[model samples]
Every structure is written in structure tokens, then in C-alpha cells.
Target: MTTWMHPEIGDWEARGRRVAASGPTLGDVDVFVVDAPARTSEELEPLVVVHGFPTSSFDFAHLVDQLSDRRRVVLVDLPGFGLSDKPDAPYRVAGSADAVASVCDQLGLRRFALLSHDMGDTVVGELLARQLDGDWDVDVTRRVVTNGSIYIEMAHLTDGQLMLLSMPDERAARGPGPELLAASLVATLAPAHADVDMSAHAELQCHLGGDRLLPRIIRYIEERRADEARFTGAIEAHPSDLHVVWGPEDPIAVAAMADRLVAARPDATLTWIEGAGHYPQLEEPRSYLEALRAAIG
Candidate 1:
């Protein structure tokens, strides 16, 4: 099937692409899986990656290529984001995880390393809970958590995020449009990196809802608050090894979040990228790649 995919994501040569089922009631969307060049006899576990808010698989365009040479990496454009089907429904974060699971099932993936960033971190937590409960079909051998607003109370939310989370219909109806989203995305990066442009990616993301998806997408913030116990508890009680790589300069997912993660998961490894912002993978790709490699190493 000719599945949906954003042209600007620069993954035209992705190993494979397909539209997979998201959930019982939720619909289907495009899922991309890329295979690294086979190298060693001892192959590592394939990695099932989940992306976070406002953006799509495009957010990991560079990082995906960087890691693809080591092991297979799976990327999906969650519903209502990226080049997937925008069904004008509430874009719940947990639903994104479900979509990833469906994608995994399609690939016959049973045991793989799980890595997530931003809102995707929450999705990973949900998968962790399911794995612990023996409900999921696959095994999450290891997990990686990057910068995210896990502890919402401690996060210093961006004006655009706060704006979207407020006033519901009115804000999304007439709130920050594509321009603001582009600006907000740029602002979330390290100021020192002026050459890192996010407009191309941000513009495509803004097209997901024509300024209407913000209200629907903002439902994730509510989920983070309401499902805190289930998500965080699962994170703390997670059986396999857990790794956290944070961008300390991020105003939203700040140092406090990294600190809190370590406090809860004392055994988890934590790596801090000092000058990077919210999107550390983009702001500091080298450091992000190093930390990520170490996680699955």
C-alpha cells in the first residue's frame, strides 16, 4: 500500500514503510523500519524508537541514520502528527505507544530495545507497564529515556505548550499557528546553534491540524497528569536496564527532571548534555548519539 509519509523528512530510502493498525478503536498510520548494514555475528536487539510531541519521525532523521549502522531502528509517525492520518481525534500519548506496538507486530519484532524522547517517554512508560503485566506480545529488553516532561510539575513549559494546554478550543482555534510552532521549535534548541533550522520540519508538523490539532494534541498533557501513577510507577519498577540522556539546558524538561529520574531509578544510568536544549538529539547530535550508543552498548 502507498502509505503516507512527509516528503521533507529525508528518509525516502527508508528500508520499508507500511500502514499498521494503531489500536482496537484507533485507526492506522504509516510506520517506517530501517535496517542497518549487517556487520557482526553477535547482532544486538533491534531498537523500537518512539518520537515525542509537535514533531514527527523527522525529529530523529539524523539520529536514525547515525544508529541505523549499528542495529535496526523503527520509527513511526503517530496519528495526528507527521505524515500519518490526522483523524481529528484526541492524540493521546499512550495511543502512540500502541501504534508503535502494532508496527512492531507487523515486523514480527518480539524483543527489542526501547528508546523514547519527550512525550514518547511517557509512551515507553506505558509499554513498560504492559511488559511487566505480561500483556504485551513483545519483550522490551532494555529502555532509553531522553529529555521529557515526565514530572509535569517541575517542567518549565514553553509559552506555546502552555498556550495550547489552555482554553481548549479557543486557543487551538485561534492560537499560535505554523509560524509560532516554527519559532517555538527553534527556541527549544540551543541558542549557540544558529545553523540548526527546524522550520521545514515545524511547517510540516503544523500542517497536521491547521492549528486545530494543538487542542487535540494537548490531551497528552492531561494524560501525563492523570496517568502519572501508572507511568512513573512502571518506570520505577521497570525490570530491565534503563538509561536517561538529558539536555540540561532545556527549559521545559530541565535538570530537575533528570535529577528526579535518577532519584526514582537509582540503578539507571544518566548522561547530561550541558548546553543542549529540549531537543538534545537535534541541538547536540554528537552527544546525543554518544549517550544513545552507550545505552544500547
Candidate 2:
């Protein structure tokens, strides 16, 4: 295992790519990239992965080996989450998409495929929109959108989320507390997935934001609703190959949201990961990776 990963994470971190270079992304925001040195195959385009809220690039840690087997993998801790800088700013989908682009540029990526989960899926939508606008700044070859509330009207968020959001913004300053933060993170995934350990995830919450940035991070939920049209519209009218691999059992995103995405973009191929949860990539790593291999191909 590489020294970059926590000791608690152990050998799982050794499963695949090692960090080539990791540091602050554009705007001096810290973002780590677990990458393999140099190119393995020129035929394979790099894969840029953007993680959702409340979780960092670590969520995809388990799938890094499979994802990078052929292509170089770039995992980012979106601003306000993970190992990235959590500035007290409104974290919007569009902004995150731009950050992803900046990360690609900083890493010297000219073209890539994208896979995003939860709110991160919306960031993929922003990139789709940018592609639709003919922005040559970042070239995205394919996109795989997974469990997310991209369609606000179509999502079924949890009461825990509502309660957390309802708590005054100051609660983050007072601290959301480990238990509260831990519970909210677990609730989004399938309750049956007891095998999915979240101890590291919970620990990440407290340390990632100095235990006082939840309120600022929670603002992404509002941004999701506000940017619905622009983001979803791009998905509906996507420019490149599109795929939607969803866990029908996800409580928050729900399978219906996947259906809507596929329907809107009839060109999108939908892969169903049965008995999985919101974090399908984590819940069913093998199936998710196979689906991604097909999607990206």
C-alpha cells in the first residue's frame, strides 16, 4: 500500500494505482490524484472521476484497480469534501464541473471519460452542458452517470437529510457531530448493505472539514434543485456516449431517476446493479467496473 492512504485503510490501498502527484488543485484547493506513473496504453483515454457529497474520492478507492486497468484514473476530492479544501462557499454542480476541468488541465489531460456518483453525477451533467456549448477547454469522450438526484422532482431524499438541512446553518459551526454525520452518510445507501463499513467515512467527516464545514457542504442540495434545468437538460441532450448504471434499490436517488435519464437521452445505455445501494461502485465494485468498461468502450 502507498503511504498516501491511511493505515486503517491498509492493504486495500495497495490494490491498484499509486499516487504520481497529489496536491492543491486549481484555485489552491487541495485535491489528491491516485495515479499510475506515465501512460500504460495510448489507446485508452484517461478517466476523470468526481465523487458526490459527504464522501471524497476515497469512495472509489475499491474500484481504482479495475478502472485503471486500461486507462489512467483521476479521482478528485471536490471542493468542500474529501481531502480537498472546504471553503465556506456555495458548492454548485457547475462550479464542481469547472474544478474537474481545472484538475484535468493541471494534470495535463486533453481528453477523458467521466464517471460520477450521487451529486457528482450532476457535475457530469455540467460537463455535458459545457460540451454542448462547444467549450474546448476540456474534452470528455464518454460519461457514465450513476445514482444521483439529477432530476430533483424525481428524487426521494431521506428524512435524515431533511432534518440535517433543517438544522440552522450554524450547526456546522457548532459541529454536526460524528454520530449525526455518520448516520446521514449511511442512510443514503441500502440498509441491507451492512457489509459496507463506514467507520473510515465517518472519521473522514470530522477530519475533512475540521468538523465544522457540514453546513457549507450541505448547501449543495439547494444547488442541485437550482441548477436542475441546465444540468438535466444537458444530460437529456448529451453530446457524447452516455451510460447510466444505477442501483434500483437506492433510496435517495431511486431507480425512477435512472429511468428518466435513460428516457431523456434515448441514446444512453442503462445498466442495472441489483441489490445495490446509492454507492453502487462501492456496494458492487465488480459489476460497476464491468459496466464502466462497457460504457467507456
Candidate 3:
């Protein structure tokens, strides 16, 4: 097993632990978890953050400190992504939601705010659905939906993404290596963020031979396409106050999706980070955090 050596990755791994999450059909799998406590003595609803596809909990490494300063923040690297174990099994949006629920159960979190991105948004939708169906007991005080195709139809699928979707839904003997994956991720960023070094994130993506699981992990997109109502519908129906924070320059999950989301739910608020793209939290952390904090506040 080859490990990627990067200072940031090392620091992030040190802050989290690998736990055996046994939830519904997902079975027992090792999931990476990070629980950062609040800095102040006050108690606020903990923030549970779910990362997007091809990445892990490390996506929020930049904002964890500030986010935790106000209230506890929890994150997880779901199976087949980040520092977690990558099983050669089919991945489903429901299973991902199960893993998240198991982690929250293990941590004893009854009430928490949700913050999700990309594919994580779908996972959040499932969680919300479970909550609505009375299958999950946790209370979602609020939610923040970042750059993701919550409205999959409105998204502009990149060529690489389209190609991935066309391939067999099984682990490839070989796949786009870390560098190529890194470049692909960087391509989604706004032009102004061209200088960002996404190498470390890509390195983590390749950790534990995860690079080869692209075909399998990317299956989540198919699930999204097949059943938007099951996932996206939960997001729309959940009574929690919705805050849509987006990067206007995102080419995939374009800005119009945000407008459509607010249209569906008139009570939901929309805030755009001007110069950022898909990964707004990474492209403009300060402004993103400001908008996030304001929304959750």
C-alpha cells in the first residue's frame, strides 16, 4: 500500500481517526472522521460537513479552524474516498448517508447543521430524506448547500466527467493518475484561482489506491441522474432553513442552479462568492466562511 506524503495531508490525517462504521447495508467499513470542538465555552449546534466526490474530509481543512471556533464541526471521509478504506463494492447515495449517520450516532450528535458539496450534496439529500421518513433520529437545524448539481439537469457536465460516466461502473485496472486528477479538479476552479496547488488534494485522492476506484465512485452521478427526486427532493422538502452558497464561476454546477433552488424554495437564501468557482471554500475561503458563518448564525 503506497501512501502520499504531503505536509497538509499528514496534518489532516493526524486530526482524525479511522473508525469501523456499521450502518444498514453498507456493512462494516473503516471511515475517517474529524471532530473539531468549539473554541469558546458556549454551546451551539455542531456543524456536520460532507465533502464532494473524488475528495474527502480534507476539503474543509482550510476552514475547519474558523468553523470550529464558533461551534463544534464534524467531518468524515466516506468509504472509497480520502484516508478511508476503499472496498471493491457498489457505492450508493443511501449507503453514504448511512455512513454519515453511523458517525453521528457514534459521536452522539442529536442536532447539527449540514454543510455539503458536490456529490456530498446528494448524500445530504438522502440523509434529509431519512430524517423526513423517521428513519434517522437526528435533528437538522439548518443546511448550507455549496456548489453541486442539486438540480442535476441544470449542471454542465465537463468532458472528463461525461467520459467517466460513459465508462463501465467498475474499478478500472488503471485510471487517471493523481496528477491528471489534480489537473482535472483545478480546471473547475475560476481562472483567478489558477495558481492554487491542488496536488496535495489529488495525492490524497490517490491514497490507498483510490485513484483506481474512480469508475466505482463516480457511479454516484448515475444514482443522482436516475433518482433526483429521491435525493434532491429531500433537500427541497426539508423544513430546515436552506442557505445556498455558490461560486458564480462554477462551470459544472453553474450559477443558475442557485437561482432555481431559491425559486423552488422561496424561503431559502442565496449568496454568491463572485470570483470563486466550484470549490468556493477552497477558492475563496475567507469570503466563503463569511457567507457560511452569516448563514448559520
Candidate 4:
């Protein structure tokens, strides 16, 4: 029902459907969801992926098959991002967490391993909190956390990010076009990964007037700053096994965050993707996949 900026990505879009879900402090709305089934008959805990800021499920278009080879892989475009409804309402991490729960409920997913990138990490943290408090009814078997500002204080916020943060916490009159969004993403990758195609990611981000909602959705960063213990604390305290696969070259989240996670959870495993930055899955797909397989294996 929507016109994609680049029709070539239609196959990826075809794999997903819009589900009725609620957002932070809002009523039921359409949330874009993708559920790639397991290829093998061997039963394995499904993997539910939460994506980062300014991007959508399309981020994993290339890896969904490999990831689902052994178990199901579910991805959702949190409201206000991707092809989801971008209503001019206040956005928060808790609501995004609820959106994930709604999608999982619709799909009959009660337990799964978790993989999160960027802002998705914070959303997972909120879900973890709910599970601990007896709010949401789901089991997070294990976790693989990539680069995100879980430790807000330790983050190196990019210029573009700072600019967006400085804007009013509401829909902007105008927002970055696809080219600008693509450039910002490219800047976060390792130098050697400068050629990664971010076109579809940027286009999907700007869909349904999503460009104007960046300021509203990015408020999750502020939420992390205001309440680190609630988010990062959940990650540290959760009983699920934790494995961290990081791109040491990430300028924003920084390598120290992963080190701190290991320090907090002594038993947690940490794998570094050499020559890769914030988006290791895109920068070094081979190394990232190997590390992911090893983490879940």
C-alpha cells in the first residue's frame, strides 16, 4: 500500500506485513514486521532482532536467511521508523518495547534469543525490565548485543546526532532527505566500509514522513541519559547468557562500552570485529556472521 523509494527492495518488503500494534503512550497502530522461519527441522529458540536508530528491519535484508537457517528471525520497524505509521506522538523506549511484544504476541512467539543493534538495545533493555517485573510474558533465552549507547555517558555522539538532539522534541517541519540520511550512516562505519549501500535504509527511514519524526524518536537517547540504570541495568542483571559482538572501530558507542559489559557480567563473552565500526554486520558481514553463529551455537 506504500510506494517505496527504491522498488528493488520490494522483495524484502514483501516478506513483511503491517501488524496492529501500540506505540509508546498511543493506541493500536500499524507496525511493520518480518518473520523469517527456521530452515531446519531441529528445534532452536527463535531470534528476535531489534534494529537501531534511523533504520528499519531492512538493515538485515542480507543476513535474515543465514540467521534463520537454524531458527526463526523476527524483525520489526518500531513505529515512527521504516514503513510503520509515523504519527506525531511522543515516542519512548518503553513503547517501542511494547511494540515488539505486540508483534511477538501476534506471531505466537513466547520465547526467543535476542539480537539488538543501536536503539534496539535500549528497547530490549526495557523489555527485560518488564520480564523481570512480571509485566511482559516472554522468555529471553540469550542475548547478542552489538554497538549501542547503553552507557550514555561513554558515548561519542556524532555531529549529526547532536544536531538532531538539539531540535525540539517534536516532529520537525522538514528533515534530512535520503542522501543526507545515507551520508550520516556512512560516516559511522569503518573507513574501509565506506562503500556499504545505505540507500534502502535511508529511503525506508524517510517513508511515511518519517524524516520529520527523527527528533521525536531520537528522544530515546535522552531517556537513556535520564535513566541508565533502568536500561543498562536490565542488560547487566538479566539471567540470560550475554554475548557481545562489537566493532572496535565504532566512534559513537566506543569499544569501552563492550568492555564495561564484560566487566559487569564477568561470564559474558565478547568478540571484536576487526576493521569494522558501528555497523559490523554491514562492514564485515563475514566476520560478523561467524561471530554471531559462534555466539548462538
Candidate 5:
């Protein structure tokens, strides 16, 4: 429940734009929400972005300003992540999609575009399926963008990712302390990028100490594995305009997965960003933003 109103975030808030939290009550969980409006009257179509595991809406902090001016950008922290409540239950990809669709319903959003990354891509695929099946009553616009994560051929997981997937009690047994674990989680995102400084490390520590960390990671892993079938099903049912963007340097998801994704959705385009690692949005913001602009437009 800690809200960082730093100068950087404050500047965006000062733009006379609006940001409000809407709790889309989905069963027992309440998904955390943030929405920013378009600057112009004609550019108000809502665009929703979902963050992956270990990260929250905070992941989109760097890109939100740019997108908010042109569209009502919605960033959500799925259950067990960010400022959301972590219920004592199994987390599945379909559950995450249901929560997202609930958020869309609460916001009264119709005909929206989706941008998802890492684990979020899995959730996006599930949500797409629900829409296609007429289970979720939201009109998803044809534009969809997925970056840095594809589950179709993701057969391998990095050591750090594996470690996170290990049971929380097992992770607790490793004894790195909450601070170290959080630092490690952030480190895994970009090993080649500049080292996370002490202050950043402290911030991560606080984030991990929050009640949401362990459950979020656990649910993220569990849901990812459980929803494999649904994910592929969604790909098979994907509309023609879907786009996949990946970082060529990402070790977790190799370029080969892109081939599988493209093969499944022959109409989808795959763009690989050079010199970027797993978190291309953070590692290569300009390039990521350019690619996103093209994909969404």
C-alpha cells in the first residue's frame, strides 16, 4: 500500500491527466488498477497493459507517460503482485485473465488494445480466448502486442527463474534474506545492464517485504504451467493482427520461440530487438517504444 509520489511520478500526475485505482472484484481477489487519460479528445481509446511476475504496474512507469497522452492507458497489478491482495489459493492463468476482464468491466472499457510482457503474455492469451469464447464480455480491439515472453516453446527456465519457481518455503530455506532475494529478482531481469545501486536495492527490499511477494511468484509459476494448453488454444484462435516482439539477447526466451509463435499465428509479425535482454522495456526503452508504436498503430 506504499505509493511513491516521487518527482518523476509527480510530473506525470501534474499533466492534468487523471489516475484512479479501480478494484475489479474477481471472486476473492481485487486487482489493483491505474488509468491515465489521453490528452486529446479524439485519442481516447483505452489501451490496457498487464505486467509480468515479480513486477507490477511499476514496470510500465517508464513508458506510461508516452502512451497516456494518446490513449487511456490502464496498468494492472495482477493478483499476488503489486498493491493487490494475495488470497490463499492456487493462481492459474485463466484466473488472471478473469481478473483482467473484470477490471475492464469495472472501467466500462470497450474495444481496447492490449500490451503485455513476460508472464503477462500468457494472461493476455488466456483473456483473448475468453473473449473469443464469449466468456468475457469485452470488445478487444484487433491490436495486440507481446514482448519479451512467449510460452509456446518456452521449455527452459533460467536458474534464477527456477529458483523463484521453487516453493516459497524452499526459497526461504536458501537464506539470502528478503533484501537479497528482491535484489536477485531484479538482477535476473537484466544481468548485463548496470548493477542495481544500493538505493534501488533498498527499494526492492521494501517491495519484497510486502505481503504480496511470495504468493505472487508462486502463483505466477503455477499459473504459467497450468495454462499451457489454454495459451496454445488462444494462439490458434488469435486474430490476424497480433504482433510479437522479443529481445534477441533474452536468455530465458530464445529467438527460437519467436519462430514457433509466428508459425502458430502465420499472420502475426515477430520483431527482435538487438542488444536488449529479458526486460527490453527497461533495457531498451526507445527501441521498445518505437516497436510498440508501430505494433499498436
Candidate 6:
């Protein structure tokens, strides 16, 4: 594994000055927490955000700042991804969810609203299951936003993703070089907008480190496939108080997927953001933030 200087990571660390950098154990995993101080009364509940695969809490940098001003915002870098310590164990969705709950407990948050995107949605589903199954006492006040994940069938995953599932070690050998990983991350966006330089962000450099831990990361992803039946079952059993805000042009989680989520949770509201792709939060921050505020309110 090669270590390279990632200015993006540095910038994110600096921006997260309000966030205490430390590892807290959650069910044997040392999970990393990036928190913005509570602007509201401590008596008020906090809003916890979870990022999906291949990305970290850094995904919520902008939203966290906005939300933190009015509410306590907690973002977590799931084990093995970000600055969190990666252990030599299999990573599963249930484990990830439990880890999230553990973080909430350690932080003394009694109840929270959830915001998740991409693979984080899967973890969120598991968290809901834990709540329903009586493993955790956390109350999910509301579900604010979702993005280029959910409805697993809709993932327009690349050949590399499918290949990763098949050959973990070989894929890891490909190396998640900063430039290669940065380019792969950039490809997820629409090409028309020159203003959106996804690569210019420092957080991208930190997450591209997945290239080095590709095998373990692939194992974590493939584990989700096995849990699909269970995850789907859980989603069906305990329907979410969800609000879906998706980019219609998203190649990964299409509008139809958001439709399916709405269909599953009929009470939930789904909105399609026009002319945006996978990363709506990054692609359309203003619109996304507006939709989020409305959803949570």
C-alpha cells in the first residue's frame, strides 16, 4: 500500500475543526466521529448523518455546517473507510448499523433524525431494523434525504464494481492511486458543468485510499449483496418515515429507484431534482438543502 499526500484530506480535517478526532468503539469496531458542536439546546435531539461506501463523513461537509448552526450535526466515518481504524474482520451491514448506534450511545444522543445516501442507505435500513427489533432505543424522528443508492437493482455500477465482487484481491492490486481514484470519482458527475470540479475537493483524495484496501472494501460491498434479502425484508417490515430526494439523471440510483422507495413507504415523499446526477448534494447544494429542510420540517 502506498501513502500519498492528499491535500483534500488536510482541508477537510481543517474544516472539521469543530469535530473532535478520535476513535470510539462500537461493537468491537473503532468507529470515527466527525461532529459539529450543538448549536441548539442539548435538550434537543441531534441529527446524525451517515455516508455510504467509498466516501466518508466528508460528503456532508457543506450540509453539516448548515444544519449544525440550528441543530447538532453528527457525521461518522464508518469503520475501515476514512480516518477510522480498519480491523481484520469481515464488515457487514448489520455490523455497520450497530456501529452507528454505538456511536450515538457513546455521544449521549438519545434520539436523532437520519440522513443517508448511497450505501449509507443500506446501513440506515439496518439501523431502523435495530430500532424495531429492540436492539437500540434511539428514536428516528425523520429521514431527511437519500441519493444515488437504494433500490439495489437500479445501481448502474461499472464493470469494475462487478469485477470487484468477483475478484477482491486482483481488484485491490489495481491500486486505488490518488489520480485513478479521483478520476473514477469524477466520472460519476455530468460533464456539461465545468464549474463543478469534483476533483478540486480535498476529501476526494482521502477516500481514494480505498484503492489500497480494495480487497477488504470489496468484501464489505459484496457482503451487502448477501444481505439484500434480509435488508429488503427489513425495509418492508419496518417502513421508513422517509423523504426521497433524488437526481433524476443519476445513473446509479435512478428516479425509478426513488419511486420504488416511495412505493415501499407510500407515506414518504419523493422529489426528482432535474439535470443532476449521482452526487446531488454536491451537484445542486442549494436545491438539495432546500429539499432537506422541507423534508425534516
Model 1, 1-297: lDDT tens digits are: 333334544544354455656675366655444434424433778887788887777788776666766577777766767666666666676677778778788778898898888888888888888888887877778888888888878878877777667755432555366666778788877788646777756665666463567678767778889998888788778888989899888878888888898898899999998689888888888888999888896
Clashing pairs in 2: none
Q: Over the stretch 1-297, how does candidate 2's per-residue lDDT look in tens digits? A: 123234554443343332222223224455445554324554688888888877777788777766667678878777666555666655555567667776677779888888888878777777778777877466678888888888887777677567657866543656665667666676766767756776666655566453576665666678667877887888777677888999888888889988888888888899998878888887777888888888885
- Best-first order by TM-score: 3, 4, 1, 2, 6, 5
Q: Which ten residues in a row have the lowest lDDT in candidate 4?
A: 22-31
Off by over 4 Å in 6: 1-8, 14-27, 40-44, 169-171, 193-195, 200-209, 236-240
Q: In candidate 3, residue 183 scores what lDDT?
A: 98
Clashing pairs in 5: none
Better of 3 and 5 by lDDT: 3
Q: Candidate 5: misplaced stretches above 4 Å?
A: 1-26, 143-149, 168-178, 189-192, 196-216
Give per-residue CA lDDT, model 6, range 1-297, as digits (tens).
324265455655654423222322235655567777766555445789888667678777767767776678888877667666555455566667766777787788887888887778788877777678887787788775566455566678766567667664432445556555556666665554425655433234244444556555555456556676555555545644678888777766667878776787788888766667777788887888888877874
Give the distance in Å from residue 186's predicted Cα in candidate 3 to where it truly belongs: 0.5
Cα RMSD for predicted model 5: 4.1
Better of 4 and 5 by lDDT: 4
The lDDT of each candidate is 0.75, 0.71, 0.90, 0.90, 0.63, 0.66
**Model 1 poorest 10 in a row by lDDT:** 33-42
For model 5, how does the per-residue alpha-carbon lDDT over 212-279 read when each residue is reduced to its tens digit? 34533445556556667776567556663777777766667666777777887788877777777667
User: Which regions of candidate 4 fall more than 4 Å away from where they truly are?
Assistant: 1-3
Q: What is the lDDT of residue 173 in candidate 3?
A: 88
RMSD of each: 3.1, 3.9, 1.2, 1.3, 4.1, 3.8
Each prediction's total of clashing residue pairs, residues at least 3 apart in sequence or on different chains, is 0, 0, 0, 0, 0, 2
